[model samples]
Target: MQNKNHELHVICVNLLATLWDYNRVGKDAEDGDIEEIISMASKSDLADQEKQVQENIHSQITNFCTFMDQILLPESKSHETTSQKHSTAPRPSGLSLAIGRNAPPDTKFEIPETKPLTFAESCQRIKDLMGYTLELKPSQIPHEQAGQGLFVDGEADVGSVIALYPGVIYSPAYYRYIPGYPRVDSQNPYLITRYDGTVINGQPWGTGGETREPWAHSNVYRPNPSEPPSETGSDRVWKMLSKPLEGSRLGFNGEVLERRNPLALGHFANHPAMVMEPNVMVCPYDFPLNEKGMRAYIPNVVFGGVEEVKMKRFGSFWFKSRGESNDGQMTGPVMKSLALVATRLICNEEVYLNYRLSNSKRRPSWYTPVDEDEDRRRWS
Candidate 1:
């Protein structure tokens, strides 16, 4: 029995390795490679030990192959880049790379290539890449009250990436010129007006000198009644458009800004209604700086230098918690895009997040902060 178990393990490992190699070659697995594995399994004593085990083996192989086909098959529109085709050599492991940390010495990180996709296709691709499917639609909780929101279509384990906060980026100067523009307040959802000068209330304005519809208005703010008011005794409002400028006498120009992309489903995500722990948190998209000719921010796994595991899990795609770096020195380029990350297990649940503009007060009742130590243990 021991020998049979060992043999089965070896066969499985070999099959997985072959699949990995086939992926690198940018080709589908040959029938012979797959048939040989099945043939070997059938001949092995292990298959006789348990009918269930045999069935499991068959199922896994089929699923793996199907996944491969989706990736390897050529798209009608070719999206492969020169760098990706040339860098198709097999890596030592399939583990997902950790962001925020410096690449190991002499390690060259390569961004994965992607094809141009319509908004629908992009949402589907995100679902495929993360193994989690989410839909942004009218909330069952009554649109008259809670508004449209995001719900998980399938199980999303803790640390899974829920979605990217897609939108057109704008500068703070653009918002300044709008007359009687509501001051940044705690009650309002973050707003990014459309490039075409459309407002959230469906009014049009030529403030930004553009004539686009407002994308930020698509995301509705569902107030969480269970959440306690600010402990600081002041209304905490977050401004989505402005941030303190670095090393300039202009005294913190709110230069960084973004409006929700109308095509992105993330715009429909709603705020938490009752203050149970929110499953999602927002962070800046970290890999492949915007200046690198990236047309849009899409969530995909990026491989780093280390090769320790086969198939890095979904959690590896987002920013991990890190202590202040060497003498407070900043690492690599700053990220321009924001991403929505899962902070806890989110299986078929209506996802919620704290939309409070201020990050100062703790909203323990409504939001569950990421436990760095726990996150490390799970991933490590």
Candidate 2:
């Protein structure tokens, strides 16, 4: 398994005192009284320590991002600007990609180690090389009540980073703000939590977009409780967050970004079936917002207020199969976000991920435990 996908895994299991504090405060603090607690947690000494780890995470994610940027380029850049010529043709969605044939024998696939690059530099180089982005056709999931699944427009190698989960990032401190609160998932299936307590509400970010735009979301959408339905508890998605907000104004919580990063659709990935193993796994990627230039490709915004909360520690992943979730890797404190990296080479087929639901909770009819032991350990 040379170049095994997620060899770095992107998870750290340190006690993350600040992270746990947020988790505790989010669940316990009375509404409107949490700002001070969160403020204190954000400035903790541990928070400073988390920043150190974040630096390494920044390097690791960019390395993988650039690596994916290189191998996913399947067309010859010299071939008539394939990205523009094929506007109607399928492009990679959930991540940026240019149309290309697989690299020829002489292409320089190896990135030089002597020169380290900022994420902005790596992203810009890839953008200049590949012109257009965002193409894909989803396939209807084969089970009853299942939603459509994300399908890549082109092939990617086994270790490639596939789609990024785009949306409003809600750290543990602000979990109460998520519409539906303790039952957030009841009204929104687009929510995904990191190994740490951070939660990403993809409900605000649809399939991304075709061009760059400034963005933010309420992170406060909940289902319309009174809506009529054909079946009991049949449907929700009411009181929703506004679709990707657009404007030229910049703020502490907003920025213009490309919506077509081919990997922006990680939220669209569905759970694998009982007999099927997941082809991709979730990795928490901490994006450094300080890099102004790279903002265009990152499809996310921090929820208001907690934008400054620095995660000081990480928690364990519930999955035993993900045994690599070790505290020895305790790394930086940045705005933690989620992304899906391929576990094996993925062709233009549907992408599947493990939801790893808690056994104590009521699961949907279609939900099947990927591993029974994992469910117990995760919720234990």
Lowest-sum lDDT 10-residue window in model 2? 241-250
lDDT of 1: 0.36
Q: Write the per-residue lDDT of candidate 2 for residues 216-276, one digit (tens) a residue.
A: 3422432334444232231121111111111211123234455546557788888887687
The candidate maximizing lDDT is: 2
Clash tally for model 1: 11
TM-score of each candidate?
A: 0.38, 0.55
- Please report how far candidate 2 places residue 249 from its true position, in Å: 17
lDDT of 2: 0.51
Summarize candidate 1's per-residue lDDT along 152-228 as a digit string, tens digits: 87666543445554432322222322223334223434343321221231122111111111122212211233455
Name the candidate that leads on TM-score.
2
